[model samples]
Target: MEEKKIVSIEDRIPKLKEARKKKANRRLLFYLSIFFLLIAAIIYLQSPLSNIKHIEVTGNKIISDEEIIQLSGLSPETNIWVINHKQLKQSIEKNPLIKEIKVKRKLPQSVQIQISEHKIVGYVKSELEYHPVLESGMIINKHNISNKGDGPLLINFDDEEYLKRMAKELGEIPDHIFNLISEISWEPTEKNKYKVVLYMNDGFIVHATLRNFASKMKTYPSIIAQLDEGEKGIVHMGVGTYFEKLEK
Candidate 1:
């Protein structure tokens, strides 16, 4: 019985050694895998592959891509993982022309910037330059007047308050009616301080008050259609709608 017990003990010892050897091999493999993964991560982070390779700008018309990129403070040197999205968005939106902006990261290589710009309603003349006026009643003081095609011109508007209100009113008008107006001149009287004179593209003058100008101008197309062919006159739209024939 003693001899049999000794042989049984001997058999268990070899089995335990095999189990310990297998466990050690697994642990070594796990450590080696982690080390290799760390090395690969470090290599990728230091390489240009982790840098921003493409910067795409969309939904920009008046503000060019170069302008937007310059404002964002983003470049090919910017790392993909370290992008400050909020700072970038706030920077781009500082321009009066930009209403809102969205910044997005396309992992590994690219970033995209999308922007919504304020609608440019008209141009306000300042000295020899024509500055763009936005729908939000803000005027951009850019000097390059030839960058955009001509639209309605705001003339003789000295009061900033009235000018802002007029810009908002013009923006609210439908495009068809807005396009017909060639110029808007502020001509206030003692009784009506908000009076404005609009020169139409169709060779007619419009007398209107800024109070309900957009609502009243909706009927302009129909009124002009009722006039005689080649007729020239001043259309009164403030108190009531009527056409006064111009003296030949």
Candidate 2:
């Protein structure tokens, strides 16, 4: 039988101490590495490396990209970490045309601004120029004499309340019928203060009131379709639905 060899406690002490020393060194090294990595990350975030290098603005029609960016109050020098997205959105929404705005950050150094603007419903004639009226009841003065699309040309609409009401009514109108309206005039009557005359692109004149304009105007296509194709006339829907052919 082979004799069993047992290591004495005194002999094993040096090896045990060496193992403990290695373990302690590994722990210290791991902590030091973690501390250095944290410091590096902090420095990187504060440095120009984290600055906004690119800015993109989209979904704007009336407001220019430059103007939207200016309104956002963000610049190339802005730090991504310190940017307040809520404040940015509020600042950009200050423009009445902007219905909603979104701000987002991309890794490295890029920012994006997405905007939703009120739809342009019509244009109010101001002297020789025409100002755009938005669905939100805001009139943009920047564009003059430049027609964006075929929308109703508002005439003699001086009352702000009436204009806003008209805008609200116009917004609810379907695109197919809304596009047919060529012009609108605020022709009020004692019976109905909200009465207005609409000149349609199809050569039919519409007499409607802003109070029930949207609901009444929705029936315009069907009413016009029933009329004689060659007969040019005035369709009355303000009080009731009827049509009268123009005298030849």
How do all models score by TM-score?
0.81, 0.84
What residue runs in model 1 are displaced by over 4 Å at the alpha carbon? Answer: 1-39, 142-146
Model 1 alpha-carbon miss at residue 127, Å: 2.6
- Distance from true location, Cα of 24 in model 2, Å: 2.4
lDDT for every model?
A: 0.88, 0.86
lDDT of 1 by residue, 137-169 (tens): 787885233248446998888888998899889
Worst 10 residues of 2 by lDDT: 142-151
Q: In model 2, which regions exceed 4 Å deviation?
A: 1-19, 142-150
TM-score of candidate 2 on Cα atoms, chains taken together: 0.84
Tell me the number of clashing residue pairs for each predicted model: 0, 0
